[model samples]
Target: MKALVTVMPKAGVLDPQGKAIGHALSSLGFAGVADVRAGKVIELELAETDPAKAKAAAEEMARKLLANTVIESFRVEVV
Candidate 1:
């Protein structure tokens, strides 16, 4: 099984990198680009074969270390 975890800055958190990307896009002639939020994606290969188990494990990893609970949130998808 494979677990794909996506971690992103929570609402109200300062994302300087995201802001910078947005500015760059606007300068490059991308019109009407309002905002951009940066995030990270982690792909994990697991020994478990079941999707449910892989998803649960991925969620636990996110809660424990992948995401900073105070300022970030994570979503898990198993394939």
Candidate 2:
């Protein structure tokens, strides 16, 4: 099974990196860009074949180590 994990900062948290990216894009003349936020994607291959199992496992992984529970939120997708 394949799992995709997306981790992003929670709302209201200051994102310096994302702000920097937005500034860079504007300087590069990317047009009317209002806001930009940056996040990370993680791809994993699991031995579990069932979609439910894969999703559950990935969720655990995110809860435990993949995401910082306080500042970041994570979404798990099974493929």
Candidate 3:
């Protein structure tokens, strides 16, 4: 099974990196770019073939090690 984990900052959190990117885009003449937030994506290949089990394990991994529950949120997709 293949698992895709996307980790992103929670709403209302300050993202200095994102802000810097937004500023750079504006300087490059990009218009209407109101905001930008940086996030991470992780792709994992698992030995398990069952979709339900793979998703559950991925969620556990996200909660335990891949993401900070307080400041980050993660979504798991199985393929």
Candidate number of the best TM-score: 2
lDDT of 1 by residue, 1-79 (tens): 8899999999999999999999999989999988899999999999999888889999999999999989998999887
Q: Which consecutive 10 residues in model 3 have the weakest lDDT in total?
A: 8-17
Rank by TM-score, descending? 2, 1, 3
lDDT of 1: 0.93
Worst 10 residues of 2 by lDDT: 31-40
Q: Looking at model 1, report the run of 10 residues with the lowest lDDT sum.
A: 49-58
For the record, the alpha-carbon RMSD of candidate 3 to the native fold, in angstroms, is: 0.7
Clashing pairs in 3: none
Judged by TM-score relative to the true structure, which candidate is superior, 1 or 3? 1
Off by over 4 Å in 2: none
lDDT of 2 by residue, 1-79 (tens): 9999999999988888999999999899897888777889999999999999899999999999999989999999988
Clashing pairs in 1: none
User: For candidate 3, lDDT tens digit of each residue in 1-79?
Assistant: 9999999999998888899999999999999998999989899899999999999999999999999989998999998
**RMSD of candidate 2 to the true fold?**
0.7
The C-alpha stretches of model 3 lying farther than 4 A from their native spots are none
Error of 1 at 40 (Å): 0.3
Q: Give residue 79's lDDT in candidate 3 (0 to 100).
A: 88
Q: What TM-scores do the predictions have?
A: 0.95, 0.96, 0.95
User: For model 3, how many clashes?
Assistant: 0
